[model samples]
Target: MTCQRRIVSCLLVGISLGLLFTPALGREVSDIKPANPNLCPKGREILKYFQSIYGKRMLSGYNVYVHTPDDYEQTGMLAAIWGRDVQWLPPVDEVIAHVKAHGYLLTLHWHWFFGGDSAWKSKRKTPVNVARVVTPGTPEHATAMKEMAAAADILEKLQEAGIVVLWRPLHEIDGGWFWWTDLDRPENTAELWRMMFRFFTEERKLNNLIWVYSAGVGDLKKKPVELRKRFYPGAEYVDISGIDLYGVNPAEDEEPYWTFFRAMAEVSPGKMLALGECDELPNPQKLAAGRLPIWLYGLPWWGTPSARRPVEQAIATMRHPFVVTLDELPAFGDEDPPPVVGILSPMDDGSAWFPEGSVTVEGYAVDRRGKVVRLEFWANDQLVGQLANPPRQFRWQWTDAPSGCYDLRAVAIDDAGQRFRSNRIHVNVGVVDAARGRPVTASGGENPSAAVDGNYYTSWRAPTEAEEAWIMIDLGQVHSIHQVNLIWGWKIHAEHFAIETAKEAPSQAASWHRVYEGKNLPWEVWKATHRARFAPTEARYVRIHFFRRAARQTWGGYDLAAVEIPIPPSKGAE
Candidate 1:
């Protein structure tokens, strides 16, 4: 027999033996035991104690939510973070496959609307009132019941699949943008709560569903406990309570973000705690340094190592310990369908004043048949944008783009013309500024140089305590930068580098803060030895001073990758 056939036969035989032997094989099935008495309602406070200890140590059996097929395909075991897409449709089968493959317990995020946008609800962009649901006689109230029924259907499906759903719906109800939030009457919030509970429990009869209450990280006073009092509906309905805090400041003066979580924990301790939704919240300088084309709050791409500190600290230690890690599970896929990769377009950097003439995208499609296909570009995943001329460099002019961040992608078509998408590329197309000129490579040692990636170019160099690299940065606008990171290339002796910030004009009083003082010790590239928090300041000058190289260090030189700056905290965002 072929090796593949033999492998499949072995798997089938192993599963059959494991199932038939049951208890003898260390497998327990066909039994139901009562959940822990301390589980959500009765032992709320006790649960909190467990979580605190659990958060500090690694967790054993919880699952991170994986929303998209790519989520499982792209990540590894030790990544620790998992996410599920907040889709409007039911994903029961997909969730089950995820659990079976990843071994992490699942949470079915009950997204309130499509794409997390209230504007696309049954009524487009129309403001819906949660209080109206309490009116038994109103049509709006009846409509709300129907929507709740749809949600109940989803719960029923999950239960039938033997899945424990982490039912987190109408999250951030304190925010005015959602359909479930009641900003006017705190009492009205309770009406909506009881409605959902009744739909899921009484109608759907989904006992396996675990209710997870989520809120924003902003001031609780604004949301007010008075509204949440009636909001709980009852302890029988909730299994976990968590708050989503995207606060950016690590400053001691600011109201601690964890204080909000502690309040929620105090109120409902029996359930599991989760981050719900989080990302690296950027302060002002980091935001500017990113040079994002839009004013969106969070970074759209992957989070960098330099930017993850605050995200780590916010969830630093959990209180009640139901923990989950990605590594404990086996590979997500072994013999599943082959992956299709595509490339996105608009490769020009954001600074381009005009569009590049023409852009082409190339994608290679390989399937289970091991067949290759040349695909065409489809806009909005639909209409064929182009027939795709060739497999080489696809170029598009700048003026042709809509002058914004456009999603560029390509697909591969089989000999049968079947198309599969390639990996996506984010294209930042914008007008180039006349005054903003690229920095010249000031004198640098032979080690560091400037290089270009696609449209934008970056320079990295080193300086010594005796020789400092003076690089100029023009903000284009007046702003303050509170935090700055000087990239020290991967060297055990990186502590030899120190960073100092100064004002652009020496005439303007000497406003300089020695942000970092390197430690004279051997360390790895990933280790951070020097760190400091500084008051927000407006300055255009930054100086890098290196005192000494690592003792017995090879190369006997300085290294740098890229400098990162975090934006100062926005007034309310912090």
Candidate 2:
């Protein structure tokens, strides 16, 4: 049978068996809901606690900008501090213990100036090639490991104190301003990310951490798809998807804020999303009225005498009915029982045909009071694989399985010695076909189609002599665009460009409006990718206008190796 026919047959069989496996797709903001409690009980509990008060109250969080340990008592808000602040504060253990004693929900953010003590030496001068610091077997890697080990020691102290921490490290990496920005080695950033995950989870054996993957809005504006694709450490490594914004004008930027939030949720489904760091708090009225995605939490940067808001305003926002403060938080130890665990994937009774000799079994487990200790995958009542101290998402590979039907289920065991089993799924070993999405259409370029052809080596280039040119794409139908990525060609480059959109085909007299403009973009052949973000704008057409090419010794033209536009999933979408 043809691939289409086989897919149809599979679907029919799936339907008859009362098991339908829809491919993972984007999600709409309205579809946002609490993740399965069995996936990350502690994380889920925290999220559920916030969700219970979502439309009624907002949580108050404060960063340790200076050495003000008393700030927690003064404001009665959740406590957030920087890892680097350990340089000037009391011992890490002492600080965390004191905060816990005060009953504050604690979180940590790391600026992580890899090569040096600070992110900058002066105003704009940052250490270069910091990406190499995370690459293995290098002198920089050695230094990085030593420094990280010291930091791990501090975190170990927290683990010993039984303090569950919302740990966000190497944040805002997509922006070029930070030292740890992967600009120098963008291709290797994923490796660097995995290295950190392994270090923190395996080497340090830190169990009190809830890892948060965070990026900056500035970077999201430049390369939305690539920024997330390149830097995302994967769902298994991240507990929360976070974004940092400073000096935000909420009235003007609300759409962009929601766009980013929706995009984060789409890319990392089942992971709680948070406003990891922000300078200005969003409107409390909007937050209480459910005008925004139910964020897990909001944390503001440290307030100094030089740039601080009235303590009254902070206090009021925290006291908002939707906000949850430390004092209002529910007790978790004995009052909260061990969470019930359930698998989220390989749907109960669902089946997959894989004649490729291998299949990946994946799912998640959560507990409200205790941490998940292990996840075991069983096939035909025999253990196939297991993960220890796994993240919410767990995966195990079954290789060289004999061609036949088999029963599979996953068992989760938590730290409290409570065990939960997933519903059994059936698998059939057979040939499987790959799935692809609809192709994109572009207006102008030597090979306009190449940009969306999924081949990174091939590119679409405007005529060599064309000083001004434009490329437009049809997304099939109108979509709420949150982010756009422009991957530059290896040799040819553009120094300036403008991104515009419209409900109809773009033209000077049409309804097209510029959403983002690029100026003096850094020139690095094949190394530079620009991402642009705007408030969610509904558009069927997107256009990029290139005005000037960068000065180069070789060919002169505007060229892009690839382009990607990621939209949020519609309501009821998979």
Candidate 3:
């Protein structure tokens, strides 16, 4: 296909994926009215800045004065999002020194003492109704309002200086350990969130502050994702969907990040996503693995880096090609209009292609004051291709990429030589996935098509049956295949399963040849990819037959990918 048509196809595929994904939101996201209609110009600018980079880049952040991010001074520096708690609240002068002076975005979190009812206290972190905090005409309500008023005053000071604040209050409300929480009762938590919203936007008229609704890590391990919606305060009350990720190994335990990313996707579609607080940051290699992306920015919780985030890991993560660092962020204070640019293809939400074929890449660009002369596409920061202002759209053809993760970006150069950047996006040119976008059927289940959508967030769940559940896909044509990858779900995993392939639809079960069978699977498969390889076989359809489900869980979220390649004994069994 031609480059222009290819761009159209990619975009159509993006929209088909989900209207709610970052890719489908496209440029409209930057132009959309802020959740808070009364948002200050500075705050809107920061929000737009994040929207522009969402899914393509992640901003490295560290709690200000925490002194931990400094460990990466050797190779990387992180200051895109500056964070701090409102204990006594930072001295306005200190805030100016740490954030404003450095042109960093400031974020404030409140760990309200609650009359010394400390949430951090190991023994006292139990959930409290906090009804008085949300209810009026009560001592707790009056005291909470006083704290908010003081916080609003601080935000107002920043607004006067054209500095913006990302106000994240009542964070981690579902985490029963927090002091002012309703916990399992998400309605109570939503009330608290909305109350804070009205007080800041309607009552105090604090336009400089952007509201960030952040969920905590506690529920990620225990509760179903449906709770994410219950805990949400609604899109009108939120500017960002944030998750505080801590207490997990970024290397081994990656499920949390993906789980939260998808959960928020369902809870508040089209909202910018953020890592409100974190104990560790994934390194560049982990990012390249295509497991985590699209955190517009992140703040490492106040603590020294340990094994979870070593100095080396911090450096690599901040130094990642697409990571927006202290020196890389746009000048928020700039008044002149620069060219706006965005990548339109390779939908960062999860568009993967096989290396066997060429892929077309595209971008969108415009200059408000000058002529956009040319647009350049770069891979891992290395200039790859450039299109001189196209007659219509910016399109570039990408071919011959190996099976690996690529960090891609676009830069628009104007007639005057001024350059503008589109947020970097991670695209996977992986081994051919035969099942991608193909027809899928299951014995019984919901969203059978999800198993082949190329997005892990959506899955083909098997019927909640005691036995005999299966999922199959048609390749439309017979081809030699040797490997299959099953990205399983958390909790609900496949315990005993088999793989079968047929050149044509089999009329009888006895006609199907079982190529691979997994019996008594090692416990390790619970949270990772289960790969089964076999001798080169030609088939038009592949089926995974499950005879027995795990006793503890039902058949649930599942995704499958098949590759046509020679035998590889090391990666999996053949």
Candidate 4:
């Protein structure tokens, strides 16, 4: 697609995913004489500024502005602009001139019909009930239309100046606390919007307005897309789509937003999505520019990084397409490079887990990109192990593991300070013994135990005949085994026993996968053995079970002496 098309697509996505809105109404603004489309010189300049930013791809570049004691000044830094008051209109010429000087557009903060500037100052939050706009000529409806016209008038000038206004009118209307709620009746909600559009466009003649709709996370529960469609002003009036979210840590709330976007995309895939505003910090690790490109409005709302410091970290982590700021909007396309000195193994480069196995690190080296590095292992102050560059997974011998918990640290150094140390990994190794022979039961009965050395350091047990019996074993490390021993008890009734291996914790018959079967043994023999040889596969659990008849001699039991798995050599195992 052309860049312009791509930008438009992105903007549309931003609109639907980022903001949601609903409204209410009163006076017949449609009947009142509409404002003439006369361009204000300052307004024209402002409109151009907004168009320069909102009309292009975020990948291109845009300027942001902030208010100052003197007239508005051009700020290189892109900052989040807030709208707290909307009682009386500002000096139109002054406000327009200030916005023009700083290259900033007016961002209207909309509230409910019953909620005037006073209510906003008191609550400092948008009122929730926004669907009441179509309440049939109510006083609240009249107040809403009047506010819409006034706000539209400001936007009209901004639009005339070629600066697009981020018109956030009647936001958070999905929440029940606001008088404009449309949760129960979405159609009426849509009607209220028709009234709003008529008042703003037909009466106020505000063509440069980029209608921003907003809703909270709760409103999504009722169906964000349905809510949007029921009240959205179609493609002509809406310039951007966004959502209002807060207090949700990106670390924790990231998934829900992803889900919400996936659903929203399905409903309105063509709108640009953005985080209209936030009263809390979002997780940077979880948010990538491609998945959810958002403009964080509030800075360091809360949390660990000192209020101001988190913003720096947030800025560091946020890449292009994702902008973070509180005071000034920075120029785009000047992102710094990724960290050079870092852990290479643990391969922070990309995800490593496969469908089949889990990773248990021996150790790894951290270093700069494209450099030969050496790793040193440390436990408290003691040196333990080391590895050179190009090495990823490290394996520790079962015997070398310490008895108690010890921190496993890996630090990398190409030359000097270019080193990274992994957070310590606690390792506690325990030992287990291997048993000899096929664990065979001496007699076929309810239960039987097979023995090796009377010392019982390593032994095997058999299953019962009443139903079916099984024995399980765990192989500590990832090893390949060629042979397995199984001993049958006197109740040698089944035609064969099935052997299986698995990687999960063994529970009542839950962890084993069938691998081998053994022929039935004659009853005369006190014990019988079974063996199997196969290519090596890493498994922690080994299980054996009678595959045929449950019991041979009695109704209530069966037996086995033991099940043993011989470990494979490490060198050629993988």
Candidate 5:
């Protein structure tokens, strides 16, 4: 059978099965309208609803690039269908009808090219030029017109069905990979994008479509910020701006991802933003903890669910309260206002110290207009605990929280749907005696024991102004240490120091490996604490080798009021 025949056969089979199980339509597409005159209402409502729950809730979406709409039917997830999929899978009209009947939002993206090949392989026989294709009165223009008219057929069907779509086309246009933005000639991609936008909106009169303009992380020559500015199709042509991200490990580095988000927001303020396509779904807990700006929607690439683990993570992320699934969405125009909340305990700028082991964190929340619905606590971008309504004072216990420093905050939601986040607090959990309070003798200090006597008033004074003086501490046992806090004596600080560790006693011939080094350390003045953090390492003997003093006078030399070390639970303990 021919390719078209095979596609038709597969679509018919899906439709037959759909008809047997499909239910009556729950909502009419015409009821949804964009708040902005230039955009579609359904698309606007989806964006508004998601923004309302951002940092308190997230919305889950999946792409059906190679699969039929029936794939989502079994999973009950919001549907993201690609324009190319219509040609080889279920027909476009059928997919729209199925989503509408099931009360699901539909997002459409087109990997469109000038020629008919969906894969976008450049033709060697006939070189493709975007400049010529966008210019009128050219053969390339005529070919592009014919191909786009065919795509218009699909949009016209959707319009006739009164189906509003989050339509993204010519996506990742800033990149050199796609034929539309070919590296050989990238000068005309912006013009080509504008031409297509006008063709679809003005000539075709496709009002039911919500125009989405998207780019990738970077271009061939420029970064995301500059590339987005260079290829922007203008605000009048786009309702939403987005980025296509893949292979993002949020646990490792989230700075670049956040940078792109902020850059897009700066370039197009008030416009909705989305994660257009990503291979890995971000942790919903982190998304709700204010790690990144509020995104309207997130749609992982179509084939991500082929792996079981990714699918599981996707499901869990979708299940988060911050994420809105098709079933959890509010009706059009019925979204409730979010409430305001604050954290009353543990001053935002202050650090809370807790002993190693089980501990309870406390905070207070309030909502002026509506009753507070829930209070959620986050630790290091992950949701650790939550409390239900009626309780203004919130407390959660961490039974096995390891010793370390954590970024802590609380998010409270009210009955009106408003979300309020408290200022972040730095919490330090430390194990006592990690340093064993043993006397750490320094070559230049006269009272070495004062450095570890757990007293802030007394001081350990160095005898002479020596750049190579060393201070050594015996941990008493081989322990895993992650952080060391040094308290500088009043008005005195070290100009340079190196933290070294060894399994054996420190001696002139001892093999002391350097763990950390610092230069020009500042005196806190108020708190007098300087913290050195590093990856956990096992050592019995630790030392601080001072190279210089901030004070030039030899009378004071170097003075340390106190030193503290924190140890986390070992892997064997867990």
Candidate 6:
């Protein structure tokens, strides 16, 4: 988007946000042990605990709500720290119960709610006028404050319950995927950070927070400190400093972790350094053997590491002495641990298609301090499957399911008769076709799934006069076979469009890998099926990201060999 358009979305309607909260009387920053002195008692205790373990040990953490500690893993780690997102926060009472039961440290981040403007939800825009956004009395200022106020409404509950937060707002500001990051205007990013600090801590009196400044692992050429220098809000506003890492095999890229450690130490001198987020957990034994300063805590983001080997490595990493799990945490006051339950399949808002008209149920549960006696899977309160003394990775298949929307959940009952519920996931199951099923999503298109739904009677069409548009199909599970067939009908499509695939659903930009690029389609290939086959690949989702669309609607269009367009053997996507 142009700079003007970036500034346009900055406009906000309501100005009554700051009026809802009482003004702040600033608390003195501590020169003592705990970094943020004004932190709630629990927050202080958590930070102090982190300080006690800095460089000497590591805390096992995950991207799951430790409703019990038995998430998806075959062997539950019951990790001590949890990574969560603000957009979909669980109920505060549930959070309090879990923390009371587990003594877990919590960290929260926001994806800026559809890249900062709900209008841009479909077509994500990365640039922002953050400098104007922080300016008082500007519409841009209104836009940000309103969001903060809405978020503060939720945060206030945690504060009232004496729950301290490791608030990591605007995380990975150097990463262009988030709305706040504007590399060309890093100073503006800093301004935005300071604005949030003053608004949350000073204006809102949210004293139950330890502000975490999380940066992205920027370009390899730039030192971590150099990448974050312009964006750091300052030592006073930030309590912990860290960076996010991904796709790095610790054994191979060990030096970068050390480089980041030293740079974060320099970035926020004397403050506790953390691994803000990671895909692969660094081996605890390797860290201890390397003889370098270890992070205060590390968060391995959700999802089992891609394949089985990494999963095994992660399980091993959590078992080492240098790593701390929930059992090792000091008790806050022993509250009976609730049976933890999680619905591991058909994620919330995820869709599925069952060829045999049956939905497969998969989940995990554990009574950390006791034994879980029964597990049940439900669809809209109707019991679909039940198990007695279910295994860690419970499995069941429900047959004769109709195609419709369903609220799915799994419940666990402990020996003490305490029943715990898994978070609900809403999913749509569609009718399968001869070609197979396609659970689809798109940037902006009517019935995008029709393109792959194998019903030639229906087809996908681009938005009239769209600057950019895209269509995506999630196959629900990875398929080894390649080739996507655009059945029947054909036409000249976008001059610049690319076909991409990822082993998993493409949530983040990192997951997408481009396999074929169609520069322009031949005009005369109408009334025929088109297939753009590349080297055989494994993928669960295929996306056609169109940079430009045809002037007229396109039914289907392609041909690499016929059009003399060469296919590369797996080209990496940025």
Best candidate, lDDT: 3
lDDT of each residue in 30-85, candidate 4, tens digit only: 21111214433433443333333431222211221221110010111233343433
**Between candidates 1 and 6, the TM-score winner:** 6
* Deviation (Å) of 332 in candidate 6: 3.3
Full candidate order by lDDT, most accurate first: 3, 6, 5, 2, 4, 1
For all candidates in order, the CA lDDT equals 0.42, 0.58, 0.64, 0.43, 0.60, 0.61
True-vs-predicted CA distance for residue 381, candidate 5, Å:
44
Least accurate 10 contiguous residues by lDDT in model 2: 20-29
Model 1: runs farther than 4 Å from truth? 1-81, 85-91, 114-124, 221-230, 249-255, 269-272, 280-324, 328-574
Writing each residue's lDDT as its tens digit, candidate 2 over 1-574 gives 2223323543453343234222122221222232222233454565456444432334556666432222332232333223324334467767865654344556776656555556642343445565667667888899879878887888788766656677777777565666666664554665666677788777777766667777767645666765566667676677667677676654335666677776677556666567777764566646534455445667766442114444445544543434544433565533433323334334321124455557776544555456788888777788878888876545567786764445567777778676666645545443221100234444455778767654444567787777778777766666666566676654467788888888875555468988899888767644246767778887777778888777651355576766666443231011
The model with the greatest TM-score is 6
User: For each candidate, what TM-score against the reference?
Assistant: 0.41, 0.48, 0.52, 0.39, 0.48, 0.53
Error of 4 at 257 (Å): 2.6
lDDT of 4 at 316: 37
lDDT of 2: 0.58
Lowest-sum lDDT 10-residue window in model 3? 565-574
- lDDT accuracy of residue 472 in candidate 6: 73
Candidate 4: clashing residue pairs, number = 80
Worst 10 residues of 1 by lDDT: 292-301
Pairs with backbone N, CA or C atoms under 3 Å apart (clashes), candidate 3: 56-424
The residue ranges of model 4 lying beyond 4 angstroms of the native Cα positions read 1-76, 80-94, 112-140, 157-162, 219-237, 251-253, 280-311, 314-574
